[model samples]
Target: MEGEHSHKPADIKARLAAGPKASYLRDWVYGGIDGTVTTFAVVAGAIGAEFSTQVLLVLGAANLFADGFSMAAANYTATRAEREDYRRLLEQERRHIRFFPDGERQEIRQIFQNKGFQGEELETLVSLITERKDVWIDTMLAEEYGRSNTQSDPVRSAGATFAAFGLCGALPLAPFVLSIPEAPSAATGLTALVFFAIGSVRSRFSTRSWLRCGLETFAIGLTAAGVAFLAGDLLTRLF
Candidate 1:
């Protein structure tokens, strides 16, 4: 049974016009998980080294801003590189279409023919696709180069990463900042919660169950903290 008016011509036309939206889910999740893990790792290390609350706060704060900004900048550069590459490829395709329409049309024909179109049907499909320059270029980008139509804004992607990193990273430093007793334990607990929360939120974009995602992220975070703690403890003993 059809639900609502989803199958209506008007609805289909509107949806197609809107096209696919660029997603920043990966940026947010990447920044959030790394922030929690790295901050907690710092906390664990400081605690193992028998550092004072003031020292822990100083270290955690430094890591939060420095690392977050670094990650954001790197993401921005990478996204800009992708956009540049797409533009270069787009221009290249446009030139090829302009200078060599026959070869381009043949490429289109071969592409669809490989997909099981045959004879008059394949010719019809090629004709339909090649009639419009925009559609023709889009088809070539998607089928030949595996490019996505939606282009994500580098600024937005970087902003999302930095925001998530700062927000989640702050959790592990909160207790020490506020001068709470048992600050290390508080930091650990808060960081653990953030890890699980980030993972659960990420599951909205994936097929995985929230529980599995949460537990997976929680384990990875704790493991990183554990390693840092061990290293700090060893160094303190050795020195």
Candidate 2:
């Protein structure tokens, strides 16, 4: 299979030793998309209002840092909360196993029984699983609470978000900072490119083709920027 690895014993042993790879793809994609969309929205609005280049640069830069940090901090807090929640549940499971071993065993048996294990097989399976305290607790956590075996690193997750946000967000302000000719159009073009690029990167984790993902993200970002531009134009005309 395309994504499958060799099932040879040695290969399996090495793979297991390496452990599960933690993915920060979601954090990066979230940050990248938001950064491009929001920064470009600011640019579009400023352009619609006929703001000076200096004003556009100021606003765009402010959004890049302020919004990026806010997003990173939020991500950190959320990831940490999830870890804490997992730990709390883990301890609770430990306590349950300690004080109510028989009940916990019944839970394990019922859980597997629902999966169709019966007779000696179920008894043997439960015995094998319960022999190890860590495995026993983990199985209960996974079966009862649907918790993942791997937890994310909050600091790493937040770092990924902040880095992606800053990198993608900077694209919109590039033209202005460089004093490019027709900087507004340049900013729009560049920001659109960033949106498409982010989507292309995102497609690696999905079933969709890169081009389709890129176009989809491009359209969404363009729509958001268009709305911002129109809003600014409407407000300008009214006031």
Q: Report the C-alpha displacement of residue 92, candidate 2, in angstroms.
A: 0.3
- TM-score per candidate, in order? 0.90, 0.90
Candidate 1 structure quality by residue, lDDT tens digits, 22-96:
999999988998888788878877877788888888898999899999999999999999999999999999999
Model 2 residue runs over 4 Å out of place are 1-8, 230-239
Q: Which residue runs of candidate 1 sit more than 4 Å off their true CA positions?
A: 1-11, 231-239
Q: Local error of candidate 2 at 217, Å?
A: 2.6
Q: What C-alpha lDDT does candidate 2 achieve relative to the native structure? A: 0.90
- Candidate 2 TM-score to native: 0.90
lDDT of 1 at 3: 29
- Candidate 1, residue 39: Cα displacement in angstroms equals 1.2
Between which residue pairs do clashes occur in model 1? none
Q: What is candidate 2's lDDT per residue for 1-239, written digit by digit as tens?
A: 78669999999999999999889999998899888888888887787788898898899889989999999999999999999999999999999999999999999999999999999999999999999999999999999999877999999999999999999988988988999998888988998898899889888888999999999988887787777778777887888
Taking every candidate in turn, the Cα RMSD to the unseen true structure, in Å, is: 2.6, 2.1
